[model samples]
Target: MKAVAGRMKRWRNSLRLRLLAGTLVWIVVAVLAAGWGLSSLFNKHVSRQFDAELGTHLDQLAANLVFDEAQTLRLRAPLSDPRLARPLSGLYWQVDRMGAAGEPETVALLRSRSLWDAVLAVPPDALADGEMHVHHVRGPNDEPLRMIEQVLRPAEYPDQALRLIVAATEDLISEPVARFNDLLGFALGALSLGLIGAVVVQVRTAWMPLERLREGLAQVHDGRNAAIEGRFPSEIQPLVDEFNGVLARNAEIVVRARTQAGNLAHAIKTPLAVLANAANRDDSALARVVVEQVALAQLQVDHHLARARAAAAVQIPGQRTAIRPVMEALVRVMERVHVERGVQITVGDFPETTAFRGETQDLQEMLGNLLDNAYKWASSRVDVKVAARNGDLVVTVEDDGRGLDASVREIVLERGVRTDEQRPGSGLGLAIVRDLALLYGGDIALDASPRGGLRASLRLPRA
Candidate 1:
């Protein structure tokens, strides 16, 4: 059931499927309507032709009708149609004397040989002199027939009235109509197939630009290109232009924000440095307190500035930084900074293509903090491992010193929370890393490392 619903959702979201389905429905309806209309028209035409032929036969029989000297009715000349003389040929003509009640009396009937051993039973209807009426009736052998009849009266014998009827089996109309319908069905079926093929071609051609646009966006998203690139039809060109404008605006905003953050940092730190210098010259208790507070203010400024920079950078597009190069550079720097401790940092094997889908500086800041914290806690060695899992880049920094308690693991990630005051740090390292990871839609966690020290694991988007 879930699989069926998934397919339904996918189909609903697909433009190609919607277009094809809509076009197919219209095609089927049009083809069926055309077939019905054409068949109806052909049936009507054959019926009119069949009735006209019967009318002509009736006129011939009427003109040849006469009376003998004994006042008995007969045909002076036989009908020109050969079917009239052929027994049970499905074509026949008859003449009947009307009784006083205006009904035809079969006792005084004269009929063609085609009516051999049977009679045409045309239903009673009021007919005017020389005016014909048509009917569907049964003839010899119970064959369905189309019939036409006329009433006539001689001038010499005005009292005597007669009815003349001409009929043929309904096959005259149905047979030709059936053959026409067969031909029409084949022709219409072929036409429907051709129309459907043309519709498919049209849909593919129309949607080609959209497919190309999607690919262009993918390339931009993957950071291979800064913006969508392709020649598009006029219909889609405006959308492409607008999207590229958005990307340009986003980059400008990030650059402007970083510049302002840097300027604000400089503006605030200069005043704080001046205060510290002034307070250091005096050895009073008030001066010492002022120095301590100035140092705290400086730390807060730096942390906020870093956060502001990362927040702006996170919004910029096409930002992919390779993990190995950044990790290697940070490791070198950390080794130089902690050279006296004799702590060695070893990076695990990782593919050169492994990368973070974020800015280079942000990755540097996050990894630098992790590595520095690991090096400080390690007795002799620090280990760095990187892996890609479930569309995330997971980096683990472990130290081989005493590990932190489970209670303090989450506590240390909070801002300004230091486990050891002698560590000589603001205690914002893990906190800053956590904030930066969160800005990039990732997370950081602390665990007991297999190396018997703290394990700082970071999960970030993999590019």
Candidate 2:
């Protein structure tokens, strides 16, 4: 129920739904308006028929009423005229007269017995000759009647006026029009129901492509597929095609990255073996010199390996990770490594600085390299900091110890090019760090820290 209610709410808030519902309502309204207009027109036509028939009856009644020279009024028609005897039928007639003549002729002219005792109600004011008008009358059954009345004077006695009324029950005049109205209402209802059904079908048909799109996305998210391909409606095919293109490109890049890692491994290992062999040889002073050369070459190989490994750890655009945990883990690992040396490394406090746009392990490895370099050379302490600056992950590591030669400043970052000949190390620390930075699509530079020691700054891309 809740889900259905939510769906209804969403539909109600949607512009498309509003348009559909508005259209259906307008259609129903139009039907009702047309029905009302047409019903009124048809009712007028029915009333005209009644009026025409009544007019004919009035003419007949007028012809029948004639006054002799004595001004005596008499009805020539029988009370049983076929028109008047029809019960529950539509037609009626009545005639009224004042005294006419003979024996003071206090007799009535004519009347429909349908009125029972009641007389037709006519205007009190005199009517001109042939001036047709309408009046209300009552039947003997007491039902309402609409009488079309006319006043007439015979040709011989023009002063003696007569009222001739012809009428039919209002029900007779209105029945067909009422039936038309009922049918019109039923038709509007049926049309509204049909329109609602069509609206539902239209909405489902229109959004079917979107549903398919969501299912395609779900397949990719579940790792069951790397790309989407299906027949889509023409309007939405472009969007699905673009998303498929992205997925295809990402899949291609992943394959290339894997291949590059393997090739980089092969490229470094052969040279590394040669270097190890050369470094193991001990023959002359120059041979001892060859060991230094070979040791440096091996350092370059190791740096290449680290670079190849870092390549696989890179994140795509718009990706992000929590940095503090990776940083803390590295710090703990470094502290554990230097436990025997009594080195106290203090990481700066930046509590809310967690999010960064890079792979977690890559950042941790980069920090590890820079801090390890500091740990090796620092006489007392090393300080590390991380913060975001101008769309970069800005990392700074500082140590208070002897700095390197200004001339060989850049050479320190070259693969295996250590400034100190007697440091007795592989000399690939800075080089490996540089390669890792480059592999992760970032950069690192060495400079004098504010504490008069080596400061290394690493900048990785932001999301």
Candidate 3:
């Protein structure tokens, strides 16, 4: 469930997905609109043709009409359509005589044989002679129909006018329209699928350049390249150029800061050396005071300068330092420095691939302090282990010597705080390690070791 939620969040945040979703919505709406419009047009066209067929039949029936000597109207020749000749065949025609003055009834004179004994009953209306009218009406079988009617006076009997109607079932038009709509729906469905496929291809093609840009940035982050590289589409090339420019500016700033820190260190160390030499040549209390203050000033300068260098190094991108070599080198040096004590420095399970994400100098400085403290307090064994966990590198230094009390573990991390006053050296090792770790977004912790000694665990960014 968490994985599904993570994927959903990523999709919601993706530009390509949002663009594709919006495009598909518009495509659906457009397809529906077009389908509706085309179906309407087709229905209108089919209806017109159906009505024209009825109109032709009406015209034929009117032309074939004849009046007998008694003035009774009849068809001289039957309609050519076979459906009109069959009883209840859904096609029919009828004739009606105009009623005399003050008469409200119309007299039915003749009708097509298809009507059997029934008639096509049209609604009564004041229709002009020679004019055609159309309506939806009920036929012989009470079935729905499209009826066309006309009123006319025959040339043989100019004063006697007759009403004529021809009708066919409404199914003739409805069935065709329904079938057309079904076929249209199928065709449009296929077209929609094709369009959706085209949209998917288009979106992927358009986003390819961004994918390449992401890969290039990853290369830079992994210390494989100093800046983004490779050709890009014209639209995305400008962004690539701007990003490289920012990286260049950042590199320049880091170089300038490093150079300034170096110059400051050189400038201050010379003045401090002269003061120390001048104090040693004199024996007065004033010279001794100057000597001690100069020493303290030198220490302060060194401490802040180390911090400045670490701060600057953290800002430089793509820095990776292998932990194994640094730990091995520190162990060799510390073993030789404490040769008389016979301290057996042993490295624990430290993978060669485990690396710090900062400068080599900073990693060395932080680990050097921790290992040195462990070596100083160790009886016969010192152990150092380096491992990576949760985007951070952890280095554990353990010594088999008397460990500090639990209450003073936190206090020792303070500046100038020593666990034993008898121990020879300034009490700034752990404090310097803490300051440097914090500068690089890392931390150092002190704990009692399982080996009955101190354990200094340093956590820093991993590459």
**What TM-score, computed on C-alpha atoms, does each candidate reach?**
0.80, 0.51, 0.77
Select the stronger candidate by TM-score from 1 and 3. Answer: 1
**Descending-TM-score candidate ranking:** 1, 3, 2
Off by over 4 Å in 3: 1-12, 87-89, 96-134, 137-144, 151-163, 274-295, 331-351, 372-431, 434-459
Query: Where does candidate 2 have its weakest 10-residue lDDT segment?
Result: 98-107
Best by lDDT: 1
Q: Is candidate 2 or candidate 3 better by TM-score?
A: 3
Candidate 2 per-residue lDDT, tens place, 1-463, comes to: 9999999999989876787778777877887788788888889999888788777777777767766667676657744447576554545776766334311113336666544445555545456667888877666566778878666767786766666778878887778888888887788778778877888788778877878888877655433455665889888888888987886677578658867776876787677677667757757787777776766666565566566556654523334667778888888998998777677888877656456555565666677778888888887889888777875677888888887666777888887576677754666777777777787667887888777888888887654
Q: After aligning candidate 3 to the native by TM-score, how far in Å is the CA of 337 from where it should be?
A: 5.8
Cα lDDT tens digits for candidate 1, 195-267:
9999999999998999999999887876778899978999899999999999999889889989999999999
Q: What is the lDDT of residue 239 in candidate 3?
A: 97
How displaced is residue 62 in candidate 3, in Å?
2.3
Residue 355's lDDT in candidate 3: 81
- Pairing residues by index, what is the TM-score of model 2? 0.51
Question: Which structure is stronger by lDDT: 1 or 3?
Answer: 1
